[model samples]
Target: MDFKYVPTTCPYCGTGCSFNLVVVDGKVVGTAPFQRSPVNEGRVCPKGSYAHEFVNAPDRLKTPMIKKDGKFVEASWDEALDLVAEKFAQYKGEQSSVICCARASNEDNYALQKFGRCVMQTPNIDHCARLCHASTVAGLAQIFGSGAMTNSVSDLADTNCAFIIGSNNFEAHPLAGRRLMQAKKKGAKIIVCDPRRTPTAKQAHLHIQHYSGTDIALLNGMMQYIIQNGWENKDFIEKRTVGYEEFKKNVMQEKYSLENVSKITGVPVDDIKTACQWIHEAEKTTAVYTLGITQHTVGVDNVRSVGFLQMLTGNMGKPGTGVNPLRGQNNVQGACDMGALPNVFPGYQKVTDEAAVKKFEDAWGCKMPAKIGLTIPEMLDTFADEPEKLKCLYLMGENPIISDPDIAHVDKALKNIEFLVVQDIFLTETAEYADVVLPAVCYAEKDGTQTNTERRVQRWRKAQDGPGESKYDWQIIAELAAKMGMGDKFPWANASEVFDEMAALTPQYCGMNYERIEKEGLQWPCPTCDHPGTKVLHCETFAGMPDGKSVFAPIEHRPPAEQTDADYPFILTTGATIWHWPSGTMTRRSESLNRDCPTGWIEINEEDAAEMGIETGDIVTAYSRRGEVDVPARKTPDIKKGVMFMPFHFWECRANWITNTPYDPVSKTPEYKACAINVKKKEA
Candidate 1:
């Protein structure tokens, strides 16, 4: 058997760990560690190790399928493209929107947005970022003048102390966890604050189990304590930031008292002081968070609190000293950077900006829409309206049916839409409802660039050919654009040409090209070819603020939309495990991963399990006002009492069935972390 090793980036999480696909006789057989990778350095998580298995899974969609009289029939690319264009032409502006994928490459997403704006002529374009770090992008951009991770992944090694909250980094971002482990090896303090005692928590210098949805209070309390103890960075605050006085007066002094904050957050006053002390004592501290911070009614405020703590500690503009939001999907950051959000064009350029609009219009030779579009939730919600406002939806690599909050509502809305087009490698749950399903290539079949959590744009080389009739997401989109009468506008010869177009428009990626990224990827804000990519942002000044200073917003804590009552007596939180991923569109198809994880299980605190007559391995039914799901109970003390945790990986017992839709006002991110639910033992 002829054997070859192909180096590629992981398609699972935002950590962007690199590995080699082990090919035998022209077939992908397994994965080998890419030891030379700057991100992972040979270490890979369980998912990355088994990533190759899903690329050639038996269930992968091999050809386009169009639904005729409620039955899916295999069709040629021309037939499918003609039908899609015909249906899409019936809708206009707000009525037609495209939901791009977080899993696709940067080139794929950039093309998706370009097609949506120029060909479809709709400002309504968004992605899964609406479900995840939309709050991070919104809140951080307003406060820090930028929205992405402020430091590179490797910078975690230089941290004096790491204050990790809201995320189970070891599970969700394993490569980043490796860097934190390196920091610990060098004696850097690690503090974990979450409602659950995650694997990362167990490794921390301090683990403070705070109440769900009270992150703002907890952070403000710490800031108050630090300021009270004279640990506030007076010099840094005065020189580099704005609105400190308003924040200090309104939040720390007026609203939050150590006693009041402790009472609201359900964390003891002493533990809050201890967390503050660690931050106070450390010279270079990094604040890392994930969905737990963003999936709340106060998500924007929650993110701002993390920013407040870091800025108060003089942590910006340096290595190992900035607030880091570990993104979920591998290319979610890249998707956002490529302008998947409705309100902005690529590189966070506003749709309303006359100059930016004129620039893009000149480049594309088409007038751009000035009005911003609807977010994902808003797009889905529009379908529920009488006479249906949204006529068509073009979804790429996203499974909104399983991933969106309130699946029942999403189901009804999807059914009401006039036409739905889904493009993905697998026959996902969302694809089951599609009027037309376009077969798309998996990462193994595509050569493209993906920006990781660190804003490092790394190239994942094509390892093998895709199965019959399947095309790369970008190719399918470009072909669709061509059919939709935009053939002359999209003249991309290859993925490199697409990247070049994206880099030319997006200032953050101006310096990036396939050539520079081939050897070692560059972190963005690269700007020019002569300029090396930026490692740590805001080294000299914050990005694009009116006064070149970071702003500290005085945010107050808000309770979750739905609180535990006599009917729904438990607080439910959802997340992904190390063995499984969100929606499980890709991971569930993996033989090894499925063998390891098998199915979904709800993590109930031992005390709650006993109270409900539930035991480990016992089937339990968890229901909220929205819907109910039954999964085997996993009795553990890892989670806080009265709080139930489940991973939204398996569709058999979708955790989103019970997740609430109440969103943050500023960011529109659903309050997935603190929904109220009730649980009961299922009779055998």
Candidate 2:
């Protein structure tokens, strides 16, 4: 009986909490807290604590499986790989698409993009970010010159004021929640703006519940209030930013006045004034937001509005004074950094840029495509609308069937594709439609690096071997690349070799190497090995902007694409609770996690529940324009009247079944936060 504790980062949210996987005789038994990590100290979330159960579960895909006549049958790796290669060969350029997994490691994601562009010869490669925070990337990049968290995770502890909007951080990012609690202990004012009284809101000094899809209005109102009260930092604005005059001119318009804002959003004028005062009066204000701000039809506008507040208050380029987005997946930051998006290569180097394309082309020995590829939603839509356009789809570690918006449409797209290949640890919902399902190893069975919400890149070591025949995500991609006769371009011997190649290509990670970060991690924009990683960005100037300044984008509020009517007289929003992770891919497989949240339910306000004669735990059927789902009703004062909330985690009661598909024109993120629906007690 060999007992050892292998330290690794949690494969849950973007908190980047460290834990030690307890390995006995080459088998991972459980997780123990890693005490020396700077991010979480020695603590972890509930999902992280019980995350090990799925790794050794009996349901883990033990071997490759190929679907014939809609039935999956066990097949050897060669048979599966050969079939995938053959099918992918039929598709070229835009006809082929790949969905990289944000949860996978940097090496895995880097390998995937290379495979998609070089082997499959398509620029249509994207990940789950298209669903969650694509707006943050698009908007923040346009504003601050970089579309990532502007502050460090630990910097929250030093903040004098923390304004949390659109995020239930306590449930979504527990470590960040702890840091906020610590900051509170040190006399930081915490203000929360959400439609629901989230657990984080309960801890805030002010919890202002505004109407859904009114984030732009609320933020513009707050800025107007500050400007009217002479709270704008003129000196900082003049020196550190550009386009403030235009922003002020637009925001100071009577339409954005407190009364108008109050009418647009349901928040009282006094409460809006007070929220603005808190930020204005503070020495340093840090604003944190999550999917609540980004998963909207106007997601980019929502994000830019948040950035406008920070810039208006001169709350940037310092510790605890920037717009921070608490990312979702553990490696989501890394996935984006590794260039899983369609428009960019590794390090966000634009695909259309001749120099960037030439760099990759010179490195990989292939002339890359100049055209920007279709996004995940666009690719899926093509398969549905023009089935002949998309001939092959290769998915790695993503379950789009349950996670993507408009489940019926996604199902049709999957079925319409000529060839579908899914690579994952288990037979997920999306894998069900696959022509071939490749078995891939989980994080514990892989050695690679993951970047957290703060852009801190840390090493996650392999604790034990994966289940039978399962390979690391990078290994699987490399195997397919080799079979496709692109082995020379992807000659990585191992994950580290893949990382080395990626680091050489990505400017942000150029300073980092596996050996340098063996013990401690380093944040990106570390351009050289001699230079220590940057803890805070924009200290002097924004990285990619032409001038050393930021911009304020004045945006107007637009109603959600779908609004409640007499037919569907309620607003339905989708989210995740602390008990389960996204789509419940790994967390749902855990016995302990399942025990805590055995099923899915809809949260309705007490008033709505009372009016409808509905009680807690009563099964209810919810209907929308697209589809319907049955779930248990959970009455709570935390929710608002005429509103319903459901977590899109359980497959048995997929909340996305009834969710609308309206997306942001700029960021292309589906408005998972708001849609029209009607509900009633299920006939039991």
Candidate 3:
């Protein structure tokens, strides 16, 4: 029996844990711990352990298919590519949009975005980051001149204090949560601010159960108390930051006082003070958060407020300090870095910048569009409201039907499009509406690189051969580019060639090569061949600002787009579970993961469930202004009363069906964390 272990990064959350794929006689069978990996330190979460189960699942898409008579029919790759190319030729400029995938490798995203610009000649390109961390990119860039995590995952162990808010990293990002525990073991204080008493919160030294949509209020209150007690880092603010005078004046207002903030956030004034005191007392305080802070109408404001707090407390630079926004997917950070967004080229070189456009044009031998394109939300809105504006959409490895807010509207937009194409390992709900469906290989069957949440670029080594005619994402894109008459621009022979081409153009990755990161990944800003990767950003000075000093944005708290009222009396929020990842595309395919958490359920406070005569496991219907869903009820005192929690992973009970569509003006991130909803027990 020929057996070998192949090392690759986990394809789940952004924690970037690495494991060895157990291959038995040339087939991937299971996973084993890779002790040398600094990310997970030889330990992995349940999802990582079971990640290989879905790679060779029976339902893997093996052949390309084309729609005929409103039904899918197997076809040769040439036939499907011909049809796609024909359809794509009809839509040009703003009429065409490309939705790249976060699950795909950096090579895949870079190729797709390049194809969109040179072949289709459209600026409409984006991925799931617009929904998850667009605020992190926009908000942090405005403050610190960069939108990525300022500290490495391993740095959490060196923190003196960890101020966690709006994230249940213990479940969503287990490996990252492991780092927080390491800090605790070293006598570090953990302060968690969340509405639910999550496993992470339960382990906190101080848990401030704040109300939903009140992150700004809670943060402002803490800052006000810190300043009132003369704990603010006046030296850092005066030397390393700008706009502190206006920011101080804004937070010192009576509305931000501990008493008013307590009323707004439903967190006790003393608890708020305690949180501030703990942060001030600590030598190094790190602010940690996730979608809970970035999935609201005021997501940018919330993120900026966190940045302001860190800068005010002198936590901008050094180990175990600065703001950390954990990404949701394995390559979501890579997707953004590869310029899969609407407004920027690779390395965040703005499309509007003539110099950046000219550089790319000279490199690719094509005239690129200079105008900013539509984001994901804007693309969907155009599809639903003005179908003619965006006639064709090419989606690769993205399941927007289940992942996007107001999925009902997403369903409509998918159907309304003139031409739709989906490429994935499986026929997702979003692919069911596709005119052409291309089969793509999973991470185990592809050789490429994926950038984790910390800007670390790691290699994804191919462990086994893909089933049937399925091809690598970049290969499929290259083939389509060839058919679309841009073969000269995409002359790369393999993933390495693609990476070399991308690194040459993106300044942050210019120093990295496959050889340098063969065993262990390296973080970004490796600008030279001999330069070591950066672990902590802003070590000496901020990079995002032109003046080498961070700026402050004095923001005020804004209520959620939809408020609780007589019709919808409870606040509804959504998140992921420990056993399953977002949308349940890969996790649900794992028999073990599916068996553990079979379906979705709504978590109602025990008091609220009791008042409604509802029992655990009882069927309940949650109603909002847009839509409603029937799900099993789970009564738990861990959750606050007047608030409902649901995991948006199950299709039978989609939480996004009732999620509000109002998005942040700057980031365009939908308000998935807070909305108005009412729940009632289903009668027999």
Across 443-504, the per-residue lDDT of candidate 1 in tens digits comes to 98889999999999998888888899999889888888889888878888889999999999
lDDT by residue (71-155, candidate 2, tens digit) is 9999999999998888888788888998998899999999999989888889999999999988999999998889999999899
lDDT of each: 0.90, 0.90, 0.93
TM-score for each model = 0.99, 0.99, 0.99
lDDT of 3 by residue, 266-342 (tens): 98888988888889889999999999999999999999999999999999789999899999999999999999999
lDDT of 1 at 314: 96
Cα error of candidate 2 at position 671, Å: 0.5
Error of 1 at 520 (Å): 1.6
At residue 246, candidate 2 shows an lDDT of 85
Q: What are the root-mean-square deviations of the candidates from the true structure over C-alphas?
A: 1.1, 0.9, 0.7
